[model samples]
Target: MLITRRFFPYFVTQCLGALNDNIYKNVLLLLVTYSQVNELPISVNMFVNLAAGVFILPFFLFSAHAGMVADNVDKAMLIRRLKLIEFIIMSCAAVAILSQSYLVMLLLLFLMGTQSAYFGPVKYSLLPQTLKENELVTGNAWVEMGTFISILVGTLSAGLIVASDNSLVAASATVVTLAAIGYLSSRAIPALPPQGKIEKIRFTPLSGTWRSIAKVRQTPSIWMAILAISWFWFLGATYLTQFPNFAKLHLHADATVVSLLLALFSIGIAVGSWICERVSYGHVELGVIPFGVLGLTVFGVDLIFAIPPAPVDLSTVYSFSTFIAASQHYRVMADLFMVGLSGGLFIVPLYAFIQSRAEKGECAQAIAANNIVNAFFMVTAAVLSIVLLGLLEWSIPQLFLLLAALNTVVALYVYSQVPEFAQRFVSYILSHVMYRVNVTGREHIPAQGAGVIVCNHVSYVDALIIMGSSTRPMRFVMDKSISEIPLLKYLFRHAGVIPICSPKQCEKTYEQAFEHIHQALNNEELVCIFPEGRLSADGDIAEFRPGIERILAADPVSVTPMALKGLWGSYFSHKGGHALTTRPKRFWSRVEVNIGETVNGVELGRHGLHQQVSELFERKS
Candidate 1:
């Protein structure tokens, strides 16, 4: 996909933009941090945090209008235009660097931010419009990979150039050349009609801002996803904006050392993005998010302790080579890497989730609202750091400690609001780690619309395995007894699992279960039912029951026949006395979920479907 005309150009353009942004921004930051230029009116800490706020302010101010413009125009054309604006901003930045004008550079920060604010909506909205459903996760993964890699290279470039002779000329030349190339790359991107409905081009920024946010709020889950994304930026902004001062003050490091830390952090995110693509299995998977959240707080707190105390000599400074030479510094590098890695895992899925779930017509607006919130949080991060570090006299490491604590609170709240994230996290760990699941015929399960998935019930954890196999949420129709198991019950119940019973157990419960299944199917939800009506107690396929026929008669939706293989002996299965009846002896078992072609129109009775499933099972997984 990256080699194609459709995606590569856009990728190049966006990456170059991120590269140049970091280069120019860091050049200014390094000059101020090292006191290479005329003394600033404010302290170095004030200047760094102030620069972050200046750059992020435009996103808050103009993102709504930008989102509307992106949706109303051709995204390809808008991208090109935005790139051209970037070129002009770089031109002015070049002149500022040559003249050493601190205020001019600061003003250009606002202009650069304005260009990026406009570009953000177009960049995100363009992907879902241009790519296939399965490609969304891969695309987001690649974009993140490119963005962070560019940031890494740019940061290293800025550090090395600042340390070089004729630094001003080199920095000016670099930003302009990159901007021009980014503009040229934008020209090759294939044109795409805007994905949003053409609406009146409203010029009122305040009203449009509210309008976009209101659009996002229409879906509570999407809104929560946006907030989660925003919180990530908040944490990211705090760490990135203060990296220079943090390294200098805490580690007693030079500019080269700061570059090394940023490089490790950036590469970690890129690696995590690549891993997200691999683990996603050609679709966006949300299960890794909680895993990411765990790492963010864990490594973030560790970083505070990982730091060496301030040097006894104020003049002492560790260069990149010296910093890494010591074994103690390895802990700091690893901590930074893990924080970035977790952030990548946490961020990519939320971006894909919002894209897949947001209202189609308002997708861009939803992303715009995300940008607005992200900017708000990031700006707040900047301000909060100033309050903590400057006014309160807290150390940079102390600020990091605060960030980790806040992240935990924020994550718990989001999990409360959006329980599916937590549910998928559990399923994700179970399927991806405890059991290695290889799924075939994933395409047979529709990306949208209603479908019935009837799989042979091999274990009590069948619902979780099937849920993890799917990209979309699957509403499992399960036995009341299994569904009510104390631990699994809470996970399944809140996840919308439908619990059913035989007529003898409770006539009303039996009737309501079918009603709920019908409602789920009518709502275009994927409904999975174990037609065996119970787990295979003897490690063989049980004869499917007639309830499947009742479901088909009621909904008449397409049925996807799936087979769960290699799960008979796992702890959750009946092979070892009883599931969870004794101490667990095995884990990391290999399992396969084979999805057969969707059979529709003609009624396939339970027996017929069972034959197809059996045939699927017979095929080597």
Candidate 2:
């Protein structure tokens, strides 16, 4: 399995890290549970919640420095050093456990948070460097699955172990053992160095943070993606922190029941993450983002309804088996699973998009900016939960619905601001509906710079399909009559398509079109023209027009020949004297766009170029 060799070590490291984190955290919660001062004026539960918030605060303050370190140093070495730091932190945690010191435990929690903050940038930024572009979604999926599974195991084990007779010893042994495992995994990771040179580390935390923030802001899409990621964490933190209370108070369950709910949630996320890699076909398909948001909105509301009303006299001894006896418990579990699935669909794409599009060598910094925003959002969630639940007397179910509605508003706003995400949605729909487009000899088109593309026009949407496939933008020349088609005219005009009439019919229109083509080529822009000067009347190659030769003679540029096949039977094709009718028996049509060798303008005249291009098309057909 690809997960075994390439992803295992990273997975092990993440799992161990999460295990250590939760073990130590649950031990602290256990201390609060058993505290002699639990009856004090201030709520012990509130203090525990505040401690959780404080742990994430470091990410906001220090992520910039963390990003710099990840960018400057060897990544494997950095992981090794971070693992050593974990060992020290876990040792401190052990001491806190042995001594039963809340102060020490709280301090150690801060230290653990610091370690995680430092690792955040390196963890995400390393994926793009190590994995191929095609492997990114799968690699991220495995990582996310490992992280969540660890959380489930760690949360469950911590509750069971700390509730034992020898709580201190159990906690100490668990943390130290996990820390050792983490270190071993770090050792196994192959060496990966910073991809580029590093500048001097910025010591001013605020300034460094602002600078990192500014870099992301400069790229609108990156900024939007960061916002999306931040919101995910914010919503997740709120839901996760509330689960234990919800299971215990609302469902009249116990610690084991809470653990079971957590397990289901984690498993759902893992399953969803794994599925995202497959559904996306290895690319960061933004089309999945809306679907994810839809699921989140639907399942989130269902979770509120799924929760049972407060039980009279809640039980403290509910086990996993006993919890499953209640139908409401199963309903809650199903809701959590759906939530996890939606979250998986949402997060994987955002991370992949950020990795793929961020400025090279500054990925760590960009991710660092995202972490900072995420921390702020988490803080907001914490504060909002406190005010709404604690002060305003809002029920947990009400809060869940509010969050769901908020998700809809936020998703719409983000999609409106960045049309690329929506554009991908359109492209995805059109590609599947129109036909499967196959391109051959695509490498013949230069990766960079301008070239004139001459092809035999086959259908109305031919340019749209080609535009969708071509990595570089091209200006197309279309017949004046077709260019006036209502909806298509808008798209054509926006795309800078030039309209040309036959020279015999409208000589001035023909001259103006040629001038526009000339200007486009001189500006080093790709310009595509139909050398047949008209669509094929009988689905056969037509005589070549000399207009291409005239354009080429004016500017000596390489000419790329292309053909459109299977489009002959498309809805827009001239069939049975009705332009709008579809070809019979055409449920799934196969269209191929084949590009031929670049013909030297100086060597190939109009007729020679036309013959070569036509033959290439016939061969491809």
RMSD of 2: 4.8
Question: In model 2, what is the error at residue 399, expressed in angstroms?
Answer: 1.2
| TM-score for all models, in order of appearance | 0.92, 0.82
What digit string (tens of lDDT, one per residue) describes model 2 on residues 45-156? 7767767866887787789889888888888889889999999889888887887777677778888998998888888888888886667778888878888888888777
lDDT of 1 at 300: 99
Which stretch of 10 consecutive residues in model 2 shows the poorest summed lDDT?
Answer: 423-432
Q: What is the C-alpha lDDT of each candidate?
A: 0.88, 0.80
Best candidate, TM-score: 1
Off by over 4 Å in 1: 28-51, 92-106, 159-169, 309-315, 576-578, 582-585
